[model samples]
Target: MKNTPIGRLRLIGLLEGISYLVLLFIAMPLKYFAGFPVAVSISGALHGLLFVLFCLAILHVMFVHRWSIFRGFWAFVSSLIPFGTFVLDKQLRREEA
Candidate 1:
């Protein structure tokens, strides 16, 4: 899990997805309801960084794994939806096998 490209990409996707959820459900609420803008500031930055990394991972996987354009697009789109990456990760695992 630690040594392969797909493993690295899976890890990145999970982190990025969790950060996105945290930013949306937790940090955003904290900013709006609790008047704590700092939560958004920090969480936003982390999510942004993770998202960029996820994009790069997709590109790497495209080259390394020879992913089709549609597959890569779904991976990109999945990152934008809640719990999408986890679902996509399962698909990816089946593909790996």
Candidate 2:
């Protein structure tokens, strides 16, 4: 597959989604339910890295897709919120497709 702007953004979105799921479904639950915080600790670390990559991908798309500063800023901010990455993924996919 071509490494287009949309493709790269989609990959970032997928990674972010996985990270969120790990943090929420696996980590948070394990922390609260099973009384095992290890999942949260590990997933949180991975999420941190994914978050950075997501930020970079957003910056790249800001130029590659000619997104406005406001749009890019909001999009990047959205990733910090739980489940926001999924919404962003949908929006970006719609625009790209």
Root-mean-square deviation (CA) per prediction: 1.1, 1.8
- For lDDT, the strongest prediction is 1
Sum up the clashes in candidate 1. Answer: 0
Return the top candidate by TM-score.
Answer: 1
User: Model 2 over residues 8-97: C-alpha lDDT tens digits?
Assistant: 877887788789888988889889999999888899999888888888888898898789999998888778777887888878777876
TM-score of each: 0.94, 0.84
The alpha-carbon deviation from the true structure for residue 72 of candidate 1, after best TM-score superposition, in angstroms, is: 0.6
> Mind sharing the TM-score for model 1?
0.94
lDDT of 1 by residue, 66-93 (tens): 9999989999999999999899788877
Worst 10 contiguous positions by lDDT, candidate 2: 1-10
lDDT of 1: 0.90
TM-score of 2: 0.84
lDDT score, residue 35, model 1?
Answer: 97
